[model samples]
Target: MKLLIGNKCYSSWSLRAWLLMRAAGIAFTEELVPLDTPDFKETVFAAAPGSGGTVPVLVDGGIAVWETLAIVEYLHERFPESGIWPRDPAARAHARAAANEMHAGFTALRGACPMNLGKRFGPRDRGPGVARDVERLAALWGQARERFGAGGPFLYGAFCAADAMFAPVVTRLDTYGIAVDPLSRDYMQAVLAHPAFREWLTAALAEPAIVAQDEVDEPALVDLRKS
Candidate 1:
């Protein structure tokens, strides 16, 4: 398998897919392409197996999976014993729903708190849009942890697809110093403690490709504001 990813510091989608692959213990060759470069488009086009010009593209044997969720699903199907999703049908369905929600939703949070693993900033700079998004995310995390995190510290317990989907959000929260309750904080810590996440952070800190657009610093947080 070959996985094409973007800069580890800024490509949140690639982080999700990469974390999933690592959690599943799927050994695959990774190719990192710096984004926003003059040759980035052509590089992705040449590296990606399919028509889409996107990173986090997975080539499994002869098959090409473009979207992050699609790649994760493909991995789950190809390696059933990996337990990328949950074993129970209901739990699996919930996990997929959470992952899909993360894939399509949270535009405000994503736009405001773009991933920059090597940067840390204040929370006051997180404007209204980002503040609202953070509140919603905190609520979601609390719910997931209370409902399905009985078996482990992850969203669906045992680091399933749902946890992988939200791993980047954890990075965002940490990078921006977003305040959360104890449970959410614990969950975020679990994500940070993941070996793959540690590896990604190490690589991100070492990366030299810094996009000026993503270098904005978030304001520091002094206290948790009520939602």
Candidate 2:
């Protein structure tokens, strides 16, 4: 299998599927396409004909799956024993609901703070929309951890697809210095400390591309890519 991704520093959606597969120990090769490039659409089309020219396209054999959620579902179906979702019925249902919510909601925070692994900033009041989004996210994470996160630090105890879906949100919060409750903070730390996430971060720091739209107007506390 070949997973096509975008610049690790900026591609939050790409990070979701890539981290899910990598952290799950699913064997696959990766291809990185720098975002905002002239050839990006053409490249994606050639690799995944009907994929709507998106990153995180997973190509296995002759089949191509696009959209982060679609790719995740495909993996869950293909490798049921991989624990892509929780084994417990209730836990799995909760995980799916949270993951789908992440897929469709949280645009306010997402717009206010895009994920930029190469830089960090001091937190400030972004807006009421961002505040509401963060509040909702914290409440959701707390509920999941309280009920299902008994076996590990992740949302569903052990790292599962739900965690993968929120991995980039973890980065977004950390990068922008958004404060969270102790529980959510601990969960974010676990995600950052994951081996696969570390590998991805290292590569991200090494990437030379600077995508303008993904970058924020605020001054960075430090440029990790240079360090």
Best by TM-score: 2
- What RMSD does each model have against the real structure? 4.7, 0.6
Could you tell me the lDDT of residue 75 within candidate 1? 89
lDDT of 1 by residue, 1-227 (tens): 99889988789889999998898898999988888888877877775545578888887776778888888889888999998998878778877887888899888878887877776767556678888877877888787777777888887689877888999889888878788878888989999999988888787777777786876644433212111
Clash pairs (backbone) in predicted model 1? 122-218, 122-219, 122-220, 123-219, 123-220
Local accuracy by lDDT, each model: 0.81, 0.95
Task: Return the number of clashes found in candidate 1.
Answer: 5
What are the runs in model 2 whose C-alpha is more than 4 Å off?
none
Model 2: per-residue lDDT, tens digit, 1-227?
A: 99999999999999999999998899999999889999999999999997799898999999999999999999999999998999999999999999999999999999999999999999899999988988999999999999999999999999999999999999999999998989899999999999999999999999988999999999999999888
Candidate 2 backbone collisions, by pair: none
| TM-score per candidate, chains pooled | 0.91, 0.99
